[model samples]
Target: MAEGFLTTHVLDTARGIPAQGVKITLYRISGMSHRKIAEAVTNADGRTDAPILPKGTFRPGTYELVFHAGDYLRASGQAGDGVLFLDEVPIRFGMAEDTHYHVPLLLSPFGYSTYRGS
Candidate 1:
């Protein structure tokens, strides 16, 4: 059994390595609104092997993953001005069953992208 229901990873393309200490926030979508779910940080490997959602709290609905790009870049010693163009990265998706949702971010100074992964 999974301890949580959501997961993510972050790769700093500019640095060509896994991004550590990136702040990630999870949210639950409610009709036309959103509710905060949980937050976590990426490990040294740039991955969250455990679920982001609280244990035994899995449900079917839309969710969002907000990545703090600017903060991460700055913390990693990159200049804040114009560095890491994307300030906040938000990824919204849905869950249908008790399954693993791994969202990995491939990021650079001027751009970033993510997708559903195994």
Candidate 2:
């Protein structure tokens, strides 16, 4: 069985490398309201050093992982002012069980995709 935790990773598809220094924010969502639960920045490996939601804090609910893609790309010299096509990318997903949630994002300056990963 998968461990109970929430995690994420980012890849810079345009650069063909892991997206480092990307700011990520985790939010719990309810009807018409979103509450910030945690925030992290990607390390050299394009992943947070620790789980955004650790095992003890894992819960079943609707959550969103917002990636500051524009800032990251700009900082990495992949995008420029007024030229970035994609900015904050929000991946909203539902967690119904106490299992691991690995949401990985493949990103570029103009596009992005995500999937439920192992």
Best-fitting candidate, measured by TM-score? 2
Model 2 TM-score, 2 decimals: 0.95
TM per prediction: 0.86, 0.95
Deviation from native of the Cα of residue 15 in model 2, angstroms: 1.0
- Where model 1 places Cα greater than 4 Å from the true spot, the runs are 1-4, 82-84
Taken over the whole model, the C-alpha lDDT of each candidate is 0.82, 0.92
RMSD of each: 2.4, 2.0
Q: Model 2: runs farther than 4 Å from truth?
A: 1-3
- Kindly list the per-residue Cα lDDT of model 2 for residues 1-118, writing each as its tens digit: 3458998999999989999999999999998899999999999999999999888887788999999999998898888788568999999999998888899999998899999998
Model 1 lDDT on a 0 to 1 scale: 0.82
- lDDT of each residue in 38-97, candidate 1, tens digit only: 888888999765678855888878998999888987777765666455789899888877
